[model samples]
Target: MNLRRRLAWLPLAAFLAGFLPATPSLAAEPGSENMLAHRAAYRLKLDSVRDNASIEQAEGIMLFEVIDACDAWASRQRFTLLVGDRDGNIVETTSDYATLEAKDGSSLRFSLTQMTGGAVTSRVAGEASVTPQGGRIRYQEPAATEDELPPGTILPMIHTIRSLAAARAGQRIFVAPLFDGTSADGAQDTTTIISGGWLAPQPNANFPLLSTLSSARMRIAFFERNTTGQGGGAATPDYEVSLRYYENGVADELKMDFGEFVVDGRLGELQTIPSPC
Candidate 1:
């Protein structure tokens, strides 16, 4: 993937929200106001390189925010990366991604903008709806086009809820297609591998919101639609993320695989916002 495409996903402080269900119901009820409304800062640095990817050194920061907007969840992610190629050429890439998801998980509004060398390269803005027949997206910024969402598709927060449910239910693996409108392509297939069962409360006095919640270790692989898990063995993922997911919706010790290189995103600071209900 080119830098523009990579930016669409590489550092998703997305779902910047948190959730821990009382039971393994697997249903998303955004109106419950269980999601943590907070902002998190992550320090990003190169963890490894692969395929001879050009990288003298790379560093970045990702700022993530999730707000409870009365009847919906609003999230925004700001990411900036400075990369030094083999010959000492420096390129700065940045992206702003934002979304508004309804309380019922029935609708979503999304926008993503990417820049490289201070020049705008891509912009994707759209609205989508989930229905019994499936989902459809209507793009308004880049162009006027409509796309179909595969059946059984889900939005990001619901994906988190379902994954948590499956994890709590002792299911080691879960597969689903997700549409967050981060890219022009409507939905991407995902395979979530639960590394272990629930985690006991790990004390964190500095971040009181996550102090007493259970957590799970999960690794998720994102793939191009219909390119995986059918006939041949599992195809390589376009992007992969493994993290320590807390019941309160905080993810720390993030390892993001960007095809050519991997980046680690560790939480640096956190503050919870009171619900404005």
Candidate 2:
């Protein structure tokens, strides 16, 4: 993946919005107000670099907000990265993304815009729907494109719910294909998750909201789902993320791995919003 594509995924914080069951019923599906409406701010710090010698210093901020929209979940996220290279010059990359996911897990719509040096450099917008046969996407920006979603495809919110349910049931590993409209490449992602079961939140944790809910530590890896076997079996992931997830769907203590380097996102502020419902 190119640097732009790798950075594009950083603005996908909405996917981690809280999705825990309100009633503590294992069979219960998330409904209105089940997902906590909140905004979280994070400090983006360089974790490490392996192949990217151009980077000397890295810093930024990420802001993510999610709201309960009755029958759908609405979200907005932005991330800005300030990079100082060996040349003693700084470059700024900013990503802004918004999304809506139907509560039924049947549909998702997204818009993404990326800016470099204060100028719009790229845009991707699309809608995806799930059908009995499979899933499909229709793009409306940056030129039109259409593609079929691989079998057993899941959208972001549903994917989180599935993960939460699995954790609640004491399942250690889960795998599923997901399409979050982050890119126009039409590559579906297959995610594998190894999870530690639920535990009480620590008082010293950065996000106070976590203290009111059950939590788990999860290591998730993403791999491209290649149906035609064209993408060699040894194909590595585009990226991977490990984080602490709360029963209410909040994720913090994030470590994002982009093959060449790693970035850490630490929660700096968190505020719960009133649910309209």
Candidate 3:
């Protein structure tokens, strides 16, 4: 099963929180020209596992293009991911577009297109509530019938990136685990996610057109395992996610390491869009 399927069998609260920030500094306000330079295209390789055993693993190459960005909001960002399996075979792919609106808090609207077996099989749309400390996000797959998703569903990693961009420096944020209390068969699996931190700004490089940058390093722990049917004993797994953002608070790099599995991705490949006024 995929990441989303595994998480679907868990609990609803798993959607709560994820990611953090850094120490205080007189940095350029979020979304400055200095940070924009860091924005460019990159590739990723991910290893995924359960109970310390390899379940599914893939290497993904992605192109992230910045559509538009202003002091008030960033709009028109696009991402495409081509994923390959352990045997170096292309197994699945995803493409998505996002628009961010900055209010008292931030908000993001994004849609994902999933391709498998050389066909587009599913599309997902979701929104997230963004805050200075952390945020909450919820998504639904139109291909699925019920309002709630099943356990073990590895939802896309995009929401995690959105949450990090919304976080301010020196604040705590919680991301609900991937599993929302219901399984594919409608069973409840309880799990919790604890997260906290702030955005740390990085100095500008030789590139003058780029803006300053900031990053958040997060630690995640999964409590209470439900291994009743899998035959394996219950085990608590720990994970680490490191996120890097540019153009003030837009995501540019995302790295997730679950000890057993690791995913490293970068955003690039710019396309012009109507600038937010």
Candidate 4:
């Protein structure tokens, strides 16, 4: 599925964005697909706030879905958050993000729109390619411009497929430049941390498909390209997401750290869609 999505503030949508992937071709190998095509609703709330933080309270809901479109994967996510500041004033923000990705890790189309107080604040839409020699990103909205993606750039779906396959194969971590079309930056260097090893099929009684799949716990951090942190090494990540993910690509129990405050996403609902395969 993907480490995918972004909210207007997107702190919520952003977490899911990390997990969602673009569409994969029907030729995808077994055990590397999205596994479960499903719609998920996550309830979000303040997990914590730094003492000096301006955000005193936060609450929101995220609606996300992934569809098996036969030849490719299609996904849509909507995030809305009502945040209260130290002054006790409330602000509402929302973001809508969507994508259609090829199954062979060759291409992707993405769109993201953000609004605050019911007015559009920002929008970005584009198409990108993935290849061994690097690819190009052609932005079609907000402005007409093109950028070069660094060599070895992988889109979300392929990144997830490779990551999961590695984890299942006993590899602990891997770093890659990921281009999900979520930000203006052509690609962000991502470091994925896998933990708890690979799990056995514990079977979720609530979701039939989950009952047959093994799972993993992972944390992924997104770092801006060419940026350095305090010690002159890699810069601190802009955001971090931790979640439990199933082999079929279903994710639950999420933690999103947005610097100012942290939010948690609890899966309130899940329904798997039938795949054409």
**Candidate 4 lDDT by residue in tens digits, 87-112:** 98888888888777776767878888
**Regions of candidate 4 where Cα sits further than 4 Å from its true position:** 1-30, 203-205, 227-233
CA shift at 258, candidate 3, in angstroms?
Answer: 7.6
Predicted model with the maximum lDDT: 1
The candidate scoring highest on TM-score is 1
Model 2: how far is 193 from its true place, Å? Answer: 2.7
Measured on C-alpha atoms, candidate 3 has an lDDT of: 0.38
lDDT of 4: 0.73
TM-score of each: 0.88, 0.85, 0.47, 0.86
Query: For all the candidates, what are their Cα RMSDs to the real structure?
Result: 5.0, 5.1, 10.6, 5.2
Error of 2 at 33 (Å): 5.4
User: Where does candidate 3 stray beyond 4 Å?
Assistant: 3-39, 46-57, 65-89, 99-110, 126-169, 172-215, 219-240, 257-260, 267-276
Clashing pairs in 1: 18-249
Worst 10 residues of 3 by lDDT: 7-16
lDDT of 1 by residue, 1-277 (tens): 3666565552122432332211222344632344578888999998988877887678999888877666566778888988887899988999888777765667777788999899998898878887656789999878889999877777777777677777767888889888888788778888889996887887886777787888889998887888443621148877788888776667877887777888888999987878876
Candidate 4, residue 206: lDDT: 67
lDDT at position 123, candidate 3:
56
